[model samples]
Target: MYAIHSVLAGLLAGSASMSALEVKSEVGRSGEDGIFQSKGIPSPATNDAATSANFKLLSGMADPNGASLDVLHDGRIPRSEDDPRSNFFFAGGSNGGRILVDLGKVIDVSSIATYSWHPGSRAAQKYQVYVADGSAEGFSAELKEDADPTKAGWEKLGEVDTSGEQPGQHAARLSPAKGKSLGKCRWVLFEVRKNPNAGPFNDTFFSEIDIIDAAGPELVRIERPKKVIRQFGSKHGNFRYTLDVSAAPDLEEWCAEHLIPVMDEWYPKIIEMLPVEGITAAESITFTLRNPADLPQNLRGVPAYASGNSVVFNADFMRRQQTGEAIGAGVHEVVHVVQFGGTREKSARQRGRANRPPSWVTEGVADYIRWFLYEPQSKGAEITRRNFDRANYDGSYRITANFFDWVIRNHEKDLMRKLNVATHDGYSDDLWKEWTGKTVQELNDGWKAYHKKKLGL
Candidate 1:
């Protein structure tokens, strides 16, 4: 009888030790099709064990430009393809980050799922999953990315790599293999990795993570808040506009009163000022006032910036500048919307070409429109005696704006328009000479001489 019992015990132990997992990956686009369901991937769970789990970043830093770690289990997904605030990612240049989810106690983990969205290579997901119950001797909750978790009392579930998939919304589901179980696990370690072949911004934009409990009660889904969008058009009805103030509802009234009128008048004027013959300006533009807390670290101090057809503003900065520089800032960013209307510059830059204009020239033109054309009385870009020595044409922003203004006044009356066209096609220093009959340095020297004489420096 003793020998028979030993044989049965050995069989049970072997079956448990052979547990394995199967991984299923799906990819799709965002819209009415839905991120997960339409692609046959499981929807994220709101009442999953991970919802109440304590998530700790065991390794790597969270990307300040992306959402916080809490977003992974927040049960909310990004509404659009590149919604940075709605997803979490590691800092750009890092290999990737590690996330540990502790469920407090061992439970039957039925499945684990991860979701991510992006319009580029970042849409892919790459990571290994490990599980532990904490009962194993020498178990450590803190596992480094390079360390082998299985060597420290963890079980390697499986490896997930969707890198070969096309760019879009992606989902990965890990479940027990046929006729097997993942066993009871209280801790899950995600060894995330960035795409090695992609650019510096290769960190995966993780939208949400789900951990299902086999014996848990019915799951609940999280409902996202409704977006508040105020729509309007250019004065001549030639262009459409959308103002998304959902993140900063308190400033809605101020936006309507002070901001809208400026954009309604200036957006068309900027398009008219910086026209490239074959290029058409964005017929519709979106202006979003984001909550300061949700903004990327780099954009926290910036008043506003434009991307694609959207202009995003730091809500706090806009609120503080409302009585002063708010309108001017709006006009400046609107100019960027017009400047980026042609994709040639962006494509050239992506291909590592040097044909794009220098940073100063791009910003100078924007400030030229803002300080000189829109509000000359403000004299915001005026270079007086105090800033004369520091005023180089390449200093960017106001200094360059003043230089451009001087060049236009003395050399070329249609310099801004000509330079705008050059920037769209393939800008070069020689183009400055062609436009104004002088090299950039000569133009810079002439502008500085005029400034120095005016300031008596």
Candidate 2:
């Protein structure tokens, strides 16, 4: 997408070669964005982003468990990050998915600061903002967007769009008001669109959303990253992937018919991939099928997410899709379950946080297995004529899966499993060299060369 189209692009230009530093999102680093949808601010969004700023305490606002009383009025400006401890929010559905934020009590609101991010093609988000008075409950009741909002119970603001978007291995910032005050109310909603047309992923992420109390703003002194921060995403309890279908009986039926059986079948395979000990997951694993309306807007197009032994699926989304789709998706989610990596592991890595397994690799591991190991017949991970010129091993999903499969065959026999194990237990690209006697860039070079020769370019 960035226009690097020579026949042997990375090889000829050297600029396109993906180095260790070039890899964007790895595990413990991916990223969020908004609101009344849940009782609290979003952090620990399904994607791994966190923090509004890099201060020590209350640094990553909106990160899972990382909210701060001072985030809104602290007066400290937010700069984003790819750290798992970074702050952000997530909304789901298809396009126009949104988050509703309820300020529990009515406070005089003058300005709002909202920030969102994604590391790759998913970064550019188009969104419309709105605010409602305490008298309003939610968008649950339809009101006129064109009429007087106070009389109609809400006021809609102009749309905001992001630029300078690139593969997000790093983070990008989106301004809620762009430094101008938006006179406020008790409730605010951000209706977001990641894509105008359908492709694959389309959830909106919010890294920071604050209803500024600039008049009586709070100040938070800069601090270093600490345990207090990771705790925002710290996990407790055992691994479980339970399926809750109380809302949708049909989804329950489908899960019983497909998801459960396949997950049960793949459990051992994923377990076998993670060779680490002392990393036992929670005993319970749940896969909940939720009503799309009640679920967060971020979960909109997201078919499934694996967190703390639990995986949640967009029930209505799944219900409409085929049973075979759920079965293949089950393999990927279960890998996350087997990953069993958590905040504690992340905290340990923070001491030397340079090289966590990038999100692409972990995600690639999931697709690699789903396509190559589980169902090669599908050719699901094939690199096609259409996408080959721009494809990178870190491009993620099936592309990365195909790359992973190539490295496993040409370099090390156990590359995928070993890489998974290293990432789960705190290892990085150093392991890449350990297995192949080559650095990540070297491996990328070899992989690209293989493709170039195959294409006869």
Candidate 3:
């Protein structure tokens, strides 16, 4: 089993006097088990003032890759760490935005909590909170980029900066200090900011926000659909897998009848096919069938993709191609889950530079495993007379897969394994010659020539 890391910290600092507010934070937990289940800090609230409030983006643009502003108070959390549609973030190249939450009327605001989840820098939180009752002198519903909230009838409650090395589930709770009250307020503004020291895409993936009312009805938590999680393992107990069909329950029967069997047989084989020294493949993998509408617009048409130990499939595509290409596509993405399971930081440091493997090589290996080893009967990578001219070794996907198949059949039998390891340990074109006694270009040319003649093109 993989080791799980969890960290909790109490952060109590702000730009102004925080005598009335206290902050608590925690990070590094999985979504299926840990998120919104905090013990030391307040978990996200479903029946909060924000639930009935109207949210508007007052400043920066929303990232097209992330969910809209409504996601913040939707009373639902992401099912996975990297679920883009369940979180809202500012655009990559811009500064963070402001969110205005109008609670209809002033009530006693008791506490506020924010939740976020991601596997990288975007998991961190950095923002300031402000509240108002709209009766203060010079009160402005919206402030300019250079304007100060404290000068515009807004009470600067406190600031939160949970930036740290760990990347996982993170939550921040702000409540009144001992013997103090946050007082009454009707408008709450979040002045969010991107992490300056982090990468270009440092905008936080805000999953959900909660605003507790001091005197309100009993809390009614949001009810999520019961997850249909099927847990199974290899016969030898060497690997474990989970299949989740909660988002697309309609495909549950099809998955049981077809998808599960293929995964049970092929997942272990793919892991064994690509072995790297001093690196063990991920012992646990998750396969999730997601509604196409829940996916980012860019990924709605993609059959499936893998991230970390998770593989997400487009439910619409799976439904349309279940009896035809769906199983094969699942195999392809499973190959990626194994391919990217290991850490390359040590390898990059030893090589003195980070040499990313080319996309052609990456996609080629996945398709090679899918079309050649898993379902060769489909002949999915075949080069016909019509596409023979366009079939190049570096063409990616099926074309590159066909090239790899030819190389393995003609020159080296274990070429894919060697190439997989080489790419994991910092890839270079020179490694091709060392393994097959020919340059990459030579192999590309020979592959095309053989296919051209075979197709009589």
TM-score of each: 0.57, 0.46, 0.54
Better of 1 and 3 by lDDT: 3
Global lDDT of each model? 0.77, 0.51, 0.79
User: Model 1 reaches what TM-score against the true structure?
Assistant: 0.57
Candidate 3, residues 1-457, lDDT tens digits: the string is: 1122333333233322223344333333433443455454545667788998999888999999889888899888886777787899999888898999999998887778888888788888888888887887788988887788878878777677767536777777666654334667888899999965557778999999988888987876644467888887666447777889998888988887788778878887887888877667787888899987667667878999999889999998998997799999999998888888744434433432277578999899999999999889999989998888787888999999998998899889998788777766688999889988999999998988887777776
Model 1 lDDT per residue over 1-457, tens place: 0000000011112124334434333333333333455424556777888988999999999988888889899877776677788899998778887899999988887777788888887887889787888877778889866787877878777667767666676777776544334568899999998965467678898999998888888887543445788998678558888999987788888898889888988887887888876677888889998865456656767888899888999888887888899878989988988888534423332322368788898999999999999999989999988888888889999999999899888888887788787776778888877887889999888888887787787
lDDT of model 1 at position 393: 84
Alpha carbon lDDT of residue 90, candidate 2? Answer: 31
Q: For model 1, give the RMSD to the true fold.
A: 9.8
- Residue 160 in candidate 1, Cα distance off native in Å: 6.1
TM-score of structure candidate 2: 0.46
Winning candidate number (TM-score): 1
Error of 2 at 437 (Å): 1.4
Locate the minimum summed-lDDT window of 10 residues in model 2.
Answer: 4-13
- Residue runs of model 2 more than 4 Å from their true location after superposition: 1-241, 341-355
The segments of candidate 3 whose C-alpha lies over 4 angstroms from its true place after superposition are 1-34, 57-68, 76-98, 105-108, 118-127, 136-138, 145-152, 156-168, 176-184, 192-205, 213-252, 261-320, 330-388, 392-457
lDDT of 2 by residue, 371-405 (tens): 99887887888776777888887899988988888
